[model samples]
Target: MLFENQRVTPSVSGAGEFMKAALEGAEAIVLAQSSMEELVKVHKICRRRPGMKLLLHLDSMKGLSKTPEAVSFLAGYIKPDALITSSPQAAVEARRHGITSVLRCFAFDEESIDSSLKLIERANPDYVQVVPGVIPVTIRLMRAKTGLPVLAGGLVRTDADVCRAEKAGATGITSSCPDLWQAAYVSRAKRS
Candidate 1:
């Protein structure tokens, strides 16, 4: 699914970040580094925002198993719009459960890029998220190789970083910085 013209999706890990992202009019937010206890609360907050897409980062979440059973729970219980994971099995399971699966890859070197490509072939996820988004060359290569929409994440700290990723053909960007969220919103607004 498209991000509905929102280039920057807030990558939030806490209630405060969630609230700030929601308030800043983020169309989507990636929930990472959160606990099971926080899921319901964060889900409630996301529910309040009409048409907001919530993507759970399964790899970093606390108390959540990276299994198909856990994916079932997420699909049936939390009902997020998407699932972000590094596990090929988990990514496939998420799609099997009718959730949009995002395969997270760390492309620090040529070897890692090859490995990521292999993982992508295995998972066949709906989207690919490449880490350390500052690397425009990697982003370009990923898009060329996979042909799946790429969401740039990790170290995407500034508006300049966002622009670079966009120029590199990233479909969207994930940033934890609230300021960048607002900046993205404003930039999109101005373009409109």
Candidate 2:
């Protein structure tokens, strides 16, 4: 897995201590709920910190349109490693522009799971991020159905949760919890 070593990609709400902690041993970071007004600052931050992949959450990026042109603008100007969104249109556009696309799906029930799978098929995203990632069964089901790598996120507060998500076949875990961010990189031998 591309993200196996850096298992816990931190979802940042802003540029602060949490962001700094998240960058420690992490290969990627998700700019969670970033607004359009902050694009310049965010780009600068990611630029200064090379080697760490930056992912922008499109759904939460206020003023950003869900169009192919928008995706092109982001790719050409923002320069993020990837883009995450619940919109299938955005996912397609991201792929069209050669930026890695991640489909963010919420699986609360069987109906939602079915819908999410359909969306995944249509978008053909490079990866899928499942919210409320504690459900190991759902994680397995999603992986089997979509055949896309899963990045388990939401409510992942402990190291045990991280291990559980990985054991269930998640390529990696995403969390805003600083402590878990550090713990996710601990050597298995040391953890044991």
Candidate 3:
């Protein structure tokens, strides 16, 4: 329910305006496309923000140990509200540590769809994000199969995409497009 109202969790891609926009909009922010060196700095700054929920995109970060140990380390060190990862094992590890896990899935073809479905059943993440978020039918199918809240992400270019995702049973939608963070889009997402 919290996610339903707060649909736009700005995915910060770099320093400067993207990070500032992420912090400025919505209640939660996703630290994505960041380097390992930037993690501590981002965590330190975000930790100081009152009432802000931080979700780290583990898969996007570079120069980090790509293992469950890294997930454990991040949970203990950064203390993020949640973690978004493509790794099912990392999701499980995060869940074990009592942190919310968002398992990201890409459905580009049949094989990818089957694999994603299998992982969804296996991981049982708190939330599932389907990449290139335009596929409403796939989103519906994933929701039916997983029985979990879905957050559609990637390739969301307009308000219509947000509306389509919401109508297709997505619990929320995430986009890097700063224009989508405008009041018009937020109201449209809410109204839908």
Worst 10 residues of 3 by lDDT: 183-192
TM-score of each: 0.94, 0.88, 0.89
Between candidates 2 and 3, name the one with more favorable TM-score.
3
Task: List candidate 2 segments past 4 Å from native.
Answer: 17-19, 183-192
> What's the C-alpha lDDT at position 154 in model 1?
94
**What lDDT score belongs to each candidate, Candidate 1 first?**
0.86, 0.78, 0.79
Better-scoring candidate (TM-score), 1 or 3: 1
**Ranked candidates, highest TM-score first:** 1, 3, 2
| Residue-wise C-alpha lDDT for candidate 3, range 1-192, written one tens digit per residue | 335657566777655534566445566767788886677777766767776667788888887654799988987888878889888998998899988999999976778989998998788899999997899998998888788998899998887898898889998888888887665454334564
- Return the clash pairs for model 1, or none: none
Clashes of each: 0, 0, 0
RMSD of 1: 1.7
Clashing residue pairs in candidate 3 (N, C-alpha, C atoms within 3 angstroms): none
C-alpha displacement of 188 in model 2, angstroms? 8.7
